[model samples]
Target: MASNRPAPEAPYVPNDPDFGGYDEQTWEEWNPTEESVRPVRGRHRVHKKGGGGLARSSTVLGVGVIAAVGAGGIATAQDGKPPVSISLPDLGAVADSLPEAKSLPGVGALISDDSAGSPADAVTAAAPLTAAGVSSADAEQGTTDAGEALRARIMRQAENQQHQADDAVRTAAEEAAVKKAAEEATAQQKAAEQKAEAKAAAKKKKEEEARKAKAEAERLAKLAKSFAIPTSSYTLTSHFGDAGSMWSSGHHTGLDFAAPTGTPLKAVHTGTVKEAGWAGAYGYRTVLELEDGTEIWYCHQSSMNVSAGQKVSTGDVIGRVGATGNVTGPHLHMEVHTSGGANIDPLAWLQGKGLNP
Candidate 1:
């Protein structure tokens, strides 16, 4: 693993050619004894609180034993040889055999002056380690021995970032769902409003049409009260504008009402008699002129009841139906003329006064 540690300083060298200037106070001389270096059943040692009084020399001997065991195990594995017994070499006599602290392969940082201390000193420290490499943000959570604390901080940071990402995704999804719901609600409201408007419009049109129909019915009722059909119990034989070779004119110019010879012909409306006796093919005819100067002519009559200069009211008998001059059967030939003397269909004129036939 990569570690945040500086290089070590040179090991102490003595002025004497064979041995260094070892001070009794600065450096403690440690020797490996058989009892101190005895192997436990397991790889670990569990010390009791007070009576476990292992000496510092014993701790050093344990480290040396571990190193020797590791080296021996490797050599045995490589040579396909049987496992060899681990034995502590004499450090005082074979001191030159030790590798330089700076040149030690992987443990160079452990013995460095800038590091915490030697392995034994570090393990024996009283206080828990501080969060050295951890940031203040992570350290605020808690502290432990160096490696564990750093590992915990890294795990917490990753979890926190993951939580933040999950929160962002959830927030975006919620916002989108809300927006979609609002849009759908708005569209529904618009559709409902349009439906209401269309319904109102259709209702208004229906009401207007009903009102116009009622007014027209009232007008027709009033016309019916003031006018009358010229004759009753008659079948309509022919309409005006019928084309044939039956008369002087190429087209018939009168509305023919076929009835019995003595069917009474009434005045169509309140009018003055303009001409009563016809001299030609109109036979016994009577002409009535309304106050508006529109003329109504009743021809092909058996006899006339009203004379010239006489006033007549609606439904008054004016003549009798007959088969007279130029007539094939007993009928009343009725003609209408506008105030401007333009000939018009009598049936249409009757309809204008609210008559159906």
Candidate 2:
């Protein structure tokens, strides 16, 4: 049989007579735990606000154990046998040792358990942490801190990569610019050289053309000095061939000019007087030869002024005209011959320059 008497109620307040004066400020200021107190092993003093006899009783209650002057201290009225030593487990130590909670994507739960595969189990079970183990606020704060740190790291890495890319682009642009400048400079140098060469060639060509023109002028002047005319004023008396009995020879071999005796005979061009004297049947004759082997003979001259081998110029008075050759009136005779002694017409040759005898 069980007794049916009701259990007695425990005392709701401390029974120590001296504990009545303890206040909330004293309790709040008291550091009871080893982690909170500065010296783990030492005598600590507690001050009393009033000098009542209860202060002496308080000192007796604090003997043989660590004590503090606060509402939660071990002080009681029942012979001050230190109030039943309550072994309250340390909540702060449990909190400090607890594993950090992880946040799972798409799963709204805090992973607090250190058991292997706990996150996966939590996801499948859809169970959250025990109500007292981890508060929702603490889990959220941890997740926010971790996420902010990760975002900061990612941003830093992205900025570094961007800087590297920009540096590479800048270097490549500089190199390209340098290469282009070099090529342009080389091209300019080559063009300058080519222009110089072209100028030099043009200058040389101009000099050669000038030299050729000078030589041609000198050649013409030399040609003009190699022949002489028979008389300055004359009329054609008997041509090289005329059907008449005017000469001893079968046919006339030279052109005859009818002019007054003592008419001034001029040299037609510049040459050495090869012969200048009287000749058989052709009195007072003068002969001149050009450098190119062409010969001129002036017959029927009244007198001679140039000697053989004497140099004479064009328009020089070389002789006087007269009909001294084979029984003709006062006239002059002229003949032109090649180096092989072939005779040619002199009237046509002289008339080529608009000169009429």
TM-score of each: 0.56, 0.36
How do the residues 1-357 of candidate 2 rate in per-residue lDDT, one tens digit apiece? Answer: 211122123244454445564322221122233332221111222222233211112232333233333323424333334544322223333323433233323232432333435555555334333322333444454533444545655787999999999999999999999999999999999999999999999999999999997886676455444534556677887787655666666677778888888999887767778888879787778998866676788888878899999988878888887777675588878887877888878776565323446
Whole-structure CA lDDT of model 2: 0.60
Q: After superposition, how far is residue 226 of candidate 1 from its true place, in Å?
A: 0.6
The sequence of per-residue lDDT tens digits that candidate 1 reaches over residues 21-45 is 5422222222334545443322222
Q: What shift in Å separates residue 19 of candidate 2 from its native position after superposition?
A: 99
For TM-score, the strongest prediction is: 1
Which number leads on lDDT?
Answer: 1
Off by over 4 Å in 1: 1-131, 134-166
Clashes of each: 1, 6
After best superposition, candidate 2 residue 250: deviation in angstroms?
1.7
